[model samples]
Target: MAKIKDHPLRYDLVNELHARPFPALTVPCHAVYVAIKEAEHAVNRDRAADRAHLLALLDRNGSPHPQPDATHFSGAMGRHHLKWESHTEFVTYSAFGSGVSSRAFDPMEADVFPQDWLAGAPGTRLTSVLIRVEELPQDEAEMLAKLDDWFVPESLAMARVVDGAAVIAGDFRIDPAGHMRFAVFVKKGTGERRVGRIVQRLCEVETYRAMSMLGLMRARGLSGKLNTLDPQLSQLISGMNSPDHSPEEVLQTLLKISAELESLAVQFSFRFGATEAYEAIVTQRVSVMREVRVEGRQTFGEFMMRRYDPAMRTVKSVDARLRGMAERATRAAELLRTRVDVERSAQNQKLLESMDARADLQLRLQTTVEGLSVVAISYYAANLLAYIAYPVTEGLGLSKGMSMAIMVPVVILGVWAMVRRIRHKFH
Candidate 1:
């Protein structure tokens, strides 16, 4: 039997599931994460430049380069482990070091990413996060006390995740170091892989949340534009009901409104869509933790609902309003077109009526001219006949006056008969 052939993408497809594996993390470790995205037109940016930038960082560490077309990479950079992943519109870098700094949440923890190398990045930083993982204390009370010292009591959201194998706490606030902070406490005997997964989830929640808010910022900028357009559109739509404006004029205004709205929609379409996707991912990453309340503390899901959900809602509301305005403009344009067509038909009808009246007047004038021609011809024929009958009257001993009288009626009858015959032949 011939061997079955494999599909061309079979290997790639299967390997994708295992790609970007969770980092195997031990206790007393720290991680710093950064995401970078282009300031403008990020989705269509030169991706090769991003890859080159990644290569530059790897070269600085004397590390092996990732494959030419690779989207993710993992390597050792001195005392830290570097992991990089490229996304549709951005890129992320994370570095894990084996031990925490002497000062908790120290500003220097971010030094895993060299300052000079970061300055050379092709894009701006979207967000940066610092995460710390430590072994649980012998007593649970000590861990709770540490959480209080590290995070704000009012804003802290601590939970027992991974079936209580670990506890996670974060205030979701930026520290003086300009980075969000997260802390993980692992239960004794908990595997390193599980702890790593929890830390990764924390990084993702922060990263995706920041990314999602970009959409909100874009929406807020567009909101001012929408405010200007809304009143203009409403004014134009109201003009449609006015009898003073011509259909053509109203149509012109409607078309202009439609065009401007469409242009705005095109500009912000991708940002809004990307925001929605990132929001869902943020929510998913938070929910996947299966977080349960730890000592009745707030959870990540609740914090997002309170702080993040409102921003997402604003973007959605603005997006919907834009669509509604476009639809209204379209409907108004159609109505104006119909009105213009009806007015044109009425004008054509008036023109046709005037033409009919002109034709009737022309027919009457022609009949009067024909009657005059008949009278003039008979008079000339009578003279000619009277002259010819003169010689005959003398031979018959008749007077010229008598002869003329007799010829007058005979000539008139002859001319009238001749005119009738000619008119009948032509008809």
Candidate 2:
């Protein structure tokens, strides 16, 4: 029997599925998460720099290094467990500690990464969050009081998820310390892995929400630009249908608008695309929570729908308008080109007709000149015949004037016939 060879990537690909497993978080643990991204070209940022930054953080705590070229790492950083993962457009650092902070939703708990280490990060912080995990209180009334005290009542979103295995709540507001906060209350019998997954999803929701809003901000910034470009495009397109404007002039204007629009599209392409992708991730993560109503409070999905969705829609609308404007500009240019081509074709036709008329006049003038030449030749031939026949006329008893008179008509007729034959043969 022949043995089969395995693909080089088979094992690596298989292991990839298990690569970024959720942390097995115990109850009463606290997590601090931060996502960092470049101001521009984040997806193409230097990976080596990110790795070096991660190494710097690990070195601060005297922890072991990740494998060479690792995309993710899980290790102990002092008393806290640190998890770092690299993504397409950003990187995230999360530190999970064994016990909750003494103060509920305390922003100081996020100090797992030393201030100096954070200051040395390669990119800007997109979002930072502090998550508090605790065992679910048996008294529902006490939990409600804690929630009301910890979070703003107006913006709070709370729900029970995973078939009531845990309850989650967040105000989705940045506190004075500049971090979003979330609290997870797990049931007594909940698995540690399930708790970890819930915390992970919460972090992901916040991260993706922040990322998606970047697109909204970009769209809002482009509003004034679009307002100006739209009218200019409309005016240029309208000029196409007006006889007052020349096609060449209109075409120039349209081309300028098209170039400008193309440049704008190129600038925003990545941002818009990344936003849409992040938005999808956000929605998916929320849906996976399988949220049930928190009665008198908004659910996570409902909050996003009410606030976030509208902004995303505006971005999408602006993107469509930009595309539409570009298309309109293209159509206007094509229309102008067609008009120019038609005008040129008409001019060429008139030129050909004028040439044909000139050719006809020249032909008629040449015919007139040929007629005069024949008469002149005939007159000379008659005179020559008269001279040559003078002696013969005297011998034949005929007068010279009479002989010449007889030859004149015959010479004229002969010259006319000869000229006609030449013209016919050439033709």
Candidate 3:
């Protein structure tokens, strides 16, 4: 059993409560802890102020009602309803809630509680109940049962029993929400067993909450990364059709994708804490090439200075010119590579147009040749026909040569008209 110091009750109530620890009960809402000391005489005049501060905390958090008496302050705080029970020299505050949880004990509020009421000495007692039940032995159940009976249900009390051992227990209700409301009792016995249990429970609950928060943060980061990658992929696909795009552009797009993948991989590694997974991703092969863009003005300025600068009168700037030319040549090479397919397509279109024009010209030439042949054939035929008719006509008084000559011109004109009609029909 730990020793409980007997200081003046007016200056030591908080410390006394600290010496006795309680279980860390999980509450659905928040809860509050208040320690009261018995005040005596003019020495502990600040006890009234202490009570006021505790009530203020409750009121600030939306207490249902206020305490009517100066010695007894009451209000609602967190998950619990509270009342301060004060005597001439001893004071105690009772907290009643559906459940009691660690969140109810705000460290900032505890710091603000009046220390002068305890006579300028800070309370050393563990005022917050953070004990757990799992650390106790089964044989101690009888002792715990005895301590349980001491719980006032409506008041917080502790009485020392015989044999330098005292039992402390609390009646706590587990609500449907898994919140626990405890009427705590502490038997003044070995402090080691009780305090050990309380500390363990508090740590476990805190760890669980922290892990949940981390999980949510990691999920949000992953979602953002995926959204960024989606648009980048679309842009890369569209840029593929541009005639001026280079292999470096393609490589740069791929590199950007790889960079995003690496970022995701890094986040995954941190979330999972898997070094092997990170290493595997890094080992995967990737190729990257990017064009180093030089502004046009800067490039031209450098070329002019190299070709015309008078820094060296005798020396020729052939080397500088070669360097400048090399840079231009490199850019030209990249441009050529990127636009090769487009240029080839344009050349093929021109060739097809030339072929169509040649074919049309050939068709016109063939039609003219056919017309000429028709004219010649018609003239010859007309002449032959006229000759044959000449002998017959001479007996009827017509000349053979005159008929042939006249028919020749008529035959030629008739062939020309027929050819024109044929060409018009086809065209």
Candidate 4:
């Protein structure tokens, strides 16, 4: 039997699903994660530069290069293992090393990514994180004490996740070193892969959270612009029914506002969409952790509700307002156009009436002119005929004056008949 042909990307697509697996990190390890994105047009940025930058870092550590067009790579970089992945709008690098810092959340521990190499990165750092993973202390109190010292009390969120497989905590605040920090306490006997997943999720939560907040900044600016445009649009609309402004003027201004609103929508659409996606990812990452509150402290879910969700809501509100304003402008313009059309119809009716009156007056004037033409022609013909008939009248023994008077009535009747005949033929 012949074997069936396979799809071209059969294995590639299958391999892609497992491409970026969680790093199987043993307990008492730390991970430094950073996500970089271009300052503008990140999705369309030069990906080759991203690859070259990764190669430079790999070179510094004497690590092997990834596949020619690899979107992700995991390799040994000196004492630490490095993982890099490229995404649509950003790229991330994760370095994992054995053992936690002797001094918790220490900046020096992140030296796995050399300062010089990072400085030469292709884009700005979206988020940098230092994750401290450790075996849970025998006494729960010790964990609680560490949490208090490491994170701010008011802002800290700590939770037991995955049915107590581990506990994760973070303040979600950038430290003086400009890196966010998260701590994971692995329960004894938990799988290494499970711990890795937890650590990865922690990094993701922060990265996505920071990325989503960019939408908030965009929203704030958009809101201010909308505020300025709103009154202008309202004023224009309010005058639409008033005589103060012509329909043409109102329509022109409305179109300007509508165009600007459309432009704003276009400009921020991608950013807002990306923010929403990032927000969803952050929520999902936190949810999958299945967090349980620790010491009555806030869970990741709760923290997001208080802080992150509000930012997302604000973005949504701004997007909605922009769309609403555009619609309002459209409605106003439509109304004004209708009014303009009605007014034009009225003016057209008046013009037609004037034309009708002028036609009637012209017809009357033409009739009067026809009558005068007949009379004048008859008088002139009568005199000329009488002169031509002088011989006949002389022979009849009639005077020239008597003959002219008699011919005048006859000539008038003949002229009227001739005029009627000509008018009939033309008509």
Please list the Cα RMSD from the true structure of every candidate, rounded to 1 decimal place: 4.3, 3.0, 28.6, 3.1
lDDT of 3 by residue, 1-427 (tens): 9998866675556755554344333322223343333221122435546556555555556665444544554454564445454433234444434433344333333332334433432222213332222222345545345334533333222222222132222322232322222222233334643333332222222222222223334545555655566566556555655667665566465555655565555445443332222222222210010111121112212321343223221112322332333343344445545565676788899999999999999998998898778877897879777877887878878687777777788887787788878879998
Worst 10 residues of 3 by lDDT: 285-294
Question: Clashes per prediction?
Answer: 0, 0, 23, 0
What tens-digit string does per-residue lDDT give for candidate 2 at 1-427? 9989999999999999998999999999999999999866556666899999999888888999999889999989999999999988889999999898778978778788778888888889999999999999998777888899999999899999999999999999999999999989899989999999999999999999999999998998888899999988887776677889778888887898899999999988888988899899999999999999866678999999998999999989989998888888888788788989999999999999999999999989989998999899999999998899899888988898889888999999999999999999988
The local distance difference test score of model 4 is 0.91
Write one digit per residue (lDDT tens) for candidate 1, span 333-411.
8888888888899998998898888978876886687677767887788778778877889999998888878877877
lDDT of each: 0.87, 0.90, 0.42, 0.91
Model 1 quality (TM-score): 0.85
Compute the lDDT of residue 320 as modeled in candidate 1.
Answer: 93
Top candidate when judged by TM-score against the true structure: 2
Report the poorest 10 consecutive residues by lDDT, candidate 4. Answer: 38-47
Off by over 4 Å in 2: 373-427
Candidate 1 vs candidate 2: the lDDT winner is 2
In model 3, which regions exceed 4 Å deviation?
A: 1-349, 376-392, 396-402, 424-427
Higher lDDT: candidate 3 or 4?
Answer: 4
Write one digit per residue (lDDT tens) for candidate 4, span 374-409: 899998998899889999999999998899889989
Model 1 CA deviation exceeding 4 Å by range:
363-427
- lDDT, ranked from best to worst: 4, 2, 1, 3
Estimate candidate 1's RMSD in Å.
Answer: 4.3
